[model samples]
Target: MSVTIDITGLPQERIAFGPSPLAELGAALHALSEPGHHARLHGWTTTTAAGLKPELADRLHEADFMWRSTRSDILLPAQPRETLAEELDDLDRMDDERYVAAALEINCAGFYDRSGPSPLVDAAMRQRALDLAAARGPRQAAFVRRMLADPPGTRAWIRRLLEDCDEAFFADTWRRVHVQLATDARHKTELMRRKGLSGAVAAVSSALTLEEDAHGSRLVVDKLSDGRTTAQGSGVTFLPTAFGWPHLIALYAPGWQPVIQYPVSSGELAGVLPVETVKLRLEAVSHPLRMRLCRNLARASYTTSELADAYGITAPEVSRHLAVLKKAGLLSTRRRGRYVMHQLDVAAVARIGSDFLEAVLR
Candidate 1:
């Protein structure tokens, strides 16, 4: 199954590039909560997760679904503003009907009864939403019910969540990664100019390809879902994000601009420290916590949270240790449900000595 976006008449000037702090913030939340999905972000996720306040942590837990799938415009606005504050204000200033409708659509997990009257006004649609939410879980069902009952209150709660997330971690994170995102955007823009849209698309991800036929040009994204959306008047917006690595988020929600948020290219980050990479791997296992983690992982795979509990350490601390080991190329990961399961790369660890010698000799 795949999603094809028809960009038949998409103008050259319509091809845009920029960084969205609000979008990145949403991606960060998704990465933090679903650590197993973004192995490349192990270091940043752990450090940020450790610093979150208790209240913020609880709120994030409850609202995990909103950010996880990137399905809703409320979380990731189709058109990003220059700053997060501006983006939040845009959301705040949105008309009540539009705001509530979007929230309701997301709360129901994309279950919309379009066959009925206008959204939020149709009784059948509300019932449909409630029915779908019920199947997901109790928490999700409750949230949908509350959204139907009091939309303004729910909107306020969502606003507070975004603010809290920013103050807790995203604000600082933006400052650190925004420059890199901008650099990536420039690189992509050049690629599009030099090699055309297909080249830029390929640079973003292998899962994305451009196809042309009698129907016109379409950007086909390799996704689990099957659907097609024609480019609306707003054209396509390409967003680069630092925290959204190892996965691409393509938003094709109706009544909104089509968006593709991809991980910033890391090719430019190739450092001159080939030997240092090997040293990092060796030094990573030398740490007492990491050594134990390596040994335990050698026996069985474990999530960051599970390892933290077993070692009587904070999750952030375990994450920090795990990040080092992963960077050293001594760790590997896979996803099991919502959690990232970690395992030791025994062969990589064994090759460290030989790798060091080869690098030094060369």
Candidate 2:
């Protein structure tokens, strides 16, 4: 069975910023702050009577050009400061177009050559595979069976099958089968339950199969105890065009909102800036108790009890706040005998400070 998914109702608004360039830059930078946000912000279009507005079209074109140009070779160093400082310096000196181009070039290069999938693509594919596995279970089983039966088929035939199959069918079926086989073959679920209920939940939730095409056979197991079908041979291949850009744009861009938005202030937008830095600075200084603790540690690293005594907080409260700061990457700890001494993570603090400054300046 062939299934086609039509995605519609994409956002058509032209990309517009506040009156000031600074405000615009801030919004754009903030949008890129979160993972995958840049792609969504830069990858949409509006069908206006005037044709594409020059500025909006230029921004979109630039984004794609940067993405493709750097996709093959960008590497982010372990320390973000080294890269971020250089990028910020470039932004300070260059024109908007040059700034955006350079920043995106570095971003794309770092991301593409990194050790993982692009955040946007990874989330999209995972959801797609899950939906496909759930919705067309039987059809997926049939497809797998056909593939196994004809390992040496022409690329054209394989492409036709992949394109024709409903988007939901294969993923839904694959997920169901993948889970059941994992449970039955490894008794993983049973073992997880013995560890704890949370473990059992995680085990059951770990659905979906990750297989290289070079594998000899891919098995589809039926949870209803119906049976199993294994696809044999060289495996199936899919064509790029089968995954159309329109469908992808629809999938990734669900709504038309800018990846980042800046709330306009009453005056001219020229002075608008990110308030995150101010917030962070206030957070760093606001609590007298936390400040005391920080001051004590600054003199020299100290155990929780030592700082707690100096600050007059209970041991538990001190531990709790320390845990929070540590998770924020503001603090680092080391065990010295029975005591865990706490100290600041300078690099993390610097990065947080720098990011705030950049956002505000933008």
Candidate 3:
């Protein structure tokens, strides 16, 4: 429901603010996956739409499409880069081990499972695997199956997929709007300089549902579920975004810095949506995909990633679609271990359908 991040006694220098290429890469991928975001970023996406792998291109166009793997701490940098170029360079220099760690860390797609021998088999990594086991999807499973079968040669594919995504989707937008991001970072830095950490936070608090009192700052991101993470001296890094609007993402990696990313226009990120909500039934089944998904779930329940895989889309796409439908009262969802499952409200669907028919008949 909300995440309260503890930043007690965190030095001002520890809290750095800047734009990150890695963060934007995730946002750009998000833009491609979500229809609303696609609408906002149409100019950039259309240019590179042709270069993406055929299936990926089609998936991207699908209103329900989503990319799940990018939501990892390994993909984000612990330190702030002075410029987007520097951030990109930092991203490009990461070795395979780091990529593999991230891949294994959030293997909701089952890539590491069906493949050959894995370092993840180790006890420490094994626990991580169990934690993420519930979120695996067919597409990621298939990708891993293919990679393990091909091996050595296909290893490059992982990095290439990420690099291509960043180059195609985020590069142009970054170059065009990076100055604005710098301005944002400067504004926040100046706030901390003029006032204190609390002052800077208080200033930004006006833009978000964030609260700062005796217990540090609690950024109310309803999608985050009810959890709290201490700043731990890593200093909070605020990433201002353009396309990844409406969704507030709070990321904490036990040894890495805790990062809070919000849309540049975060007027009310929390005190609201939680990834699942209730709405006025009629508005729920309005969209074709939402209705289709509702019907699909009418027969059974499926996790967000599973639904995405079945529909040949991405997790975020399905997540966003489901969020609206849930809010509109068309569906209900639950979390089982790491997997979040959704079910169609059959009675409500029937009621709404009959209501529509009766109105038309009259």
TM-score of each model, paired residue for residue: 0.68, 0.21, 0.60
Candidate 2's residue-wise lDDT over 1-362, tens digit each?
Answer: 01111112211111111122222222222232221222223332111212434554343332222222111011111111212234233334433322222223222221211233322334543333333222223443343233233423422343232222213133333333334333332343354336632343233222212222443322221111111222121111111111111111100011112111112111111122347753554476355555445433422345676555545678999987777666555577887545566865433443444332122221
When 2 and 3 are scored with TM-score, the better candidate is 3
Give the top-scoring candidate (lDDT).
1
Model 2 is weakest, by summed lDDT over 10 consecutive residues, at 243-252
The CA lDDT of each predicted structure is 0.69, 0.30, 0.55
Off-target runs (Cα >4 Å) in candidate 3 are 37-39, 42-70, 82-101, 104-119, 122-137, 145-155, 166-169, 202-224, 266-301, 304-362
Which residue pairs clash in candidate 1?
none
By TM-score, highest first, what's the ranking? 1, 3, 2
Candidate 2: segments with Cα more than 4 A from true spot: 1-285, 351-362
Clashing residue pairs in all predictions, respectively, total: 0, 11, 8
Model 1 lDDT on a 0 to 1 scale? 0.69
Per-residue alpha-carbon lDDT of candidate 3 for residues 233-338, written as tens digits (9 for 90 to 100): 5667887666555445666544446777756653211123333432466566666677556544653457886677656889999999988877777678787656
Tell me model 3's lDDT, rounded to 2 decimals. 0.55
